[model samples]
Target chain A: MALSPDDVARLARLARIDLSQAELEHLAPQLDVILESVAEVSKVAADDVKPTSHAIEIANVFREDEVRPSFTAQQALSGAPVKESGRFRVPQILQEDE
Target chain B: MSGLVLQTAADLAGLIAAGEVSAHEVVAAHFERIAQVEPQVQAFLALDEERALAAADRVDAKLAAGEKLGPLAGVPLGLKDIFTYQGLPCTVGSRILEGWHPPYDATVVKRLLDADLIIVGKVNMDEFAMGSSTESSAYKVTHNPWNLDYIPGGSSGGSAAALAAFEVALSVGTDTGGSIRQPAAVNSLVGVKPTYGSNSRFGVVAMASSLDVPGPFGRTVLDAALLHEAISGYDPMDSTSLNLPIPPVAQAARSGEIKGYRIGVVKELGGEGYAPGVLQRFNESLALLESAGAEIAEISCPHFTYALGAYYLIMPSEVSSNLARFDAMRYGIRVGDDGKRSAEEVMNLTRGAGFGAEVKRRVIIGTYALSAGYYDAYYGSALKVRTLIQQDFDAAFAKVDVLVSPTSPTTAWKIGERLDDPLAMYKADLCTIPANLAGICAASIPVGLSSENGLPVGFQIMAPAMADDRLYRVGAALERGVADAFGGPVLNQLIGSPAWDALSAQAVAARFPNIILGLAENLS
Candidate 1:
């Protein structure tokens, strides 16, 4: 519940967002206030209680493996930030220095 | 807004089907109204006038051929921007998706088109549907038509404001927490958050996947129900979609009879933190229902109090996971891909620059909550609370046919009033969040204006999962009661109220404010 600015920075890093120092300070106290309130849930719920991640019971749904009309590669890359020859152009995932 | 455009979706469809008016004329009339009033209201993000006219021409062509029409034929509609609509920009009010046009239509969009509903434009919303007020939108803040000074409730603010301002007869909105119902309550419209999974989420943007539900908003209960039926049913595209037949909401709405029905007033939702005027309107509605030959009583669902707390946890946790897809490269606007930085560095910088403050706050909270050591205390406990809330609904449904409450504790507030305070804004959803947690059906119908602020207030009705018809049965009856008691259109009663003082004729009197406010001219 006691979320310091450092902790918020760590969390933001984990979420893959590079927050400025000012944004971290601004968001930290607000998130702390929210966490303090929502922490009330932990107080009353007993360990014996079952958790519900989804509102309704989700049974697995299966479908026939049939070929259907699908988006072409051009259409799929239409909204992409960068594209190359029939593929997406993402930043390099590997380290060259290694 | 003219006489023809102000008519309900059902009435417009009737005229079109009866060969009285061409769909082109109806569509043109709405565009004329939009041209007149859009500057002040700012309800729509994009208006597809060219396509809307073409769609109308197609509908008229079918009618001239003596062919049967779609369920809601010829009515102009506003779509919430969260859904994918092929060539149209689907910005969920976030800069991250600024110029991105989805390649396909959401299942809801496809159904609306198939039903022959003309989509006039894409409406505004809170960025990623994260905020209660529409202020968090990357675009303009939509003003409540009743009074331009007040907020149109959000993240479905534009949808509600569109209906109130007569920009469109019916519109689509998705409720996560209280987005649809709260905005409906504050704006004086009929908004339904149908049973989760009743409407598919195939091409709809995901926030909190389990709780995000697309539904209909209209000026009347019957209109909402008609729109409801148009987009409700099973879809193979949405894996969690209900395989059962759509609940007969439209048919039940026409019944307008809750005689011999058991209606329960939720005990925990009221009495504290509720505005005095809101309580008065709520109590009067209870009495009105009693006079209509229904039995009412206080029903306690003890877990209702924890629903908001549980929701913030569960919703944000899902937000963290679902929004992970906006990683800069695949689609949407990318910020910091200078080529020297690694993929993770570019992603962090891009997400930091692209997302708004509220979206970042929730995603960070979500990441913290779901992180190691903290997961069990926050997200895990919230899930157990979710199970408890559902059990509470199951027990209450056994005791009563339907549950009723004041949709919001108060009416619409000024735009910036709660912006600085996230916790205070979250309380606006106390009465509506439980239904989302349980995946049950609920609706908010305008009962009266709140005397405290002279703003519109909504009466909420909730039904068990798959029993959504019960909400319509009671809502229609009460709507009739309010009409007779108030002596005109249900929303018309609020026109002369204090909220009208903001848009009064001291500037330019409406020969008919709701009808001719645009013609009123010089309106501030």
Candidate 2:
């Protein structure tokens, strides 16, 4: 339950959010306290108690592969920040020099 | 026609259907009222005048053709910004998705149009429904209609405020850990969180997917129930959406008979940290229910106390996962992608620049909780605790038909009072999170002004999943039982009537002083 700033920074990197040093300092303690408080769950979380991933029971919804009405390609690309040739455009995934 | 803005959805729908008032006029009246009070309330993120009037025209056309109208037809409704509505900026109160326009409608949005309700505008909320106060919004903070100085409880703050200010007759909001009910509690509006899967979430932006369920808000119990019925039905698009018949909520609301129905007072949700005035109003509401022929008893749900801890763990864990979609490649704003940084680096920078502090805090916590080595201790145990909480509800429901509690621990605080203290703010939903954990239905109906601060207090009611109508049934009876003493629901008198204009912010507290009895005495 004790979350250090370094621990938070590592998690932030994993979560794909680049947190500044200032945010790490400020939020780490807040998150640490939150964790310590939530850690109280360990007191009653006996192994006998089954875990509930969802409150309401639902099964994997299967459907036929039939085509249904959906967003047109034009509509699909409408909200894209960068697009070309009817596809989303992104920054370099691989460095050419490398 | 001039008093159209003040009329309930039921009244407006009746008038529109009976040809007493044109649907266009009704929509116009609400828009005009929005123009007047919106500056002070700051409830809306965007106003769609063109879309609203067009929808109104369609309703009018149906009437002209002598075709049957949909239920709640032509009534203006405020929508929470999280729901996708094509052609409007759906911010979800976050800067990351600022100016993002969804190309399609959420299933709930489509259903609202099908029901012939006019969508006035998108209302503000806590950024992605994370915070207790509306102050966390990237846009303006929504003020409570009862007192402009205090925070209207959030993350459904603006949805509650818009209706409470009478800008719209009905509004829609989603509750993930009491967003709808808490705001409804402080604003003196009726809000419902229908049973999980009872309503469709196909187009609602995901926030803690397991817990988030879109719901309805109104000035009265019946109005909320009527809106509830219109929006709730099975949709194949949502795997969790129950393929079952809609509960007869409006019918139950109309029948104010809870004779011999057993109600339980939740032992965990009250006392200790609860505000004295909030408890006073809750106790008074219990007396009303008792007099209305409902049997009441104290029911112990011991695991309920740990609901807040489990919710913070579960909700943010889901937030971290669900929000991973905003990678800046597909849609929304992309920052620092100036052809130099790699895609991963750009995604990190864009998210950092785009998200607010609260959003970052939650995502990081979610990441940490779901991370290996910590998953069993944090996330897994929270899941186990969730099972215990549901079991607690199951045992309680066996002895009682429904349970009651104060919707929120305290009335609305000042705008910035608890913002810095995240844990302090999280406690606002203390009494309401248990129902979400159990996936059961819950509602908050206006009781009266808290004696200490004079802010509105709401009485919380809970029913087993799929039995949502019971919340309406008991809420109606209690509302009727207490109606005469306060001259009506205090909310109806202060905001839902034409005379409300004179009771604006400062005037209301100075004029009424005591709860509604003082106003009733003055009116007499």
**DockQ each:** 0.84, 0.85
Question: Evaluated with DockQ, which candidate comes out highest?
Answer: 2
Root-mean-square deviation (CA) per prediction: 4.9, 7.1
Q: What DockQ class does candidate 2 belong to? A: high
Residues B1-524, candidate 1, lDDT per residue (tens digit)? 45787789999999999989989999888887776666667788877888888999999999999999976899999999999997678889887887777899999999999999999889999999988788899878888988888899999999999888777999999999989999999998999999999999999899999999999999999999999999999999999999898888999999989889999999999997999999999999999999999999889999898999999999999999999999988887776677778888888887897799999989998998899998999999999999999999999999999999999998889989999899998999999999999999999988887778778889999999999899999999999898888886667764455544443233322221221111111111
lDDT (10s digit) by residue, model 2, range B244-277:
8888899999997999999999988888999999
TM-score of 2: 0.95
Question: Model 2: residues >4 Å from true position, as ranges?
Answer: B493-524
What lDDT is obtained when candidate 2 is compared to the true structure?
0.88
Measured against the true chain A, the candidates' chain A TM-scores are: 0.92, 0.90
lDDT of candidates 1 onward, in order = 0.88, 0.88
Q: Which 10-residue span in candidate 2 chain B carries the lowest summed lDDT?
A: B515-524
State how far residue B517 of model 1 sits from its true place (Å): 27
> Model 2, residue A81: displacement in angstroms?
0.9
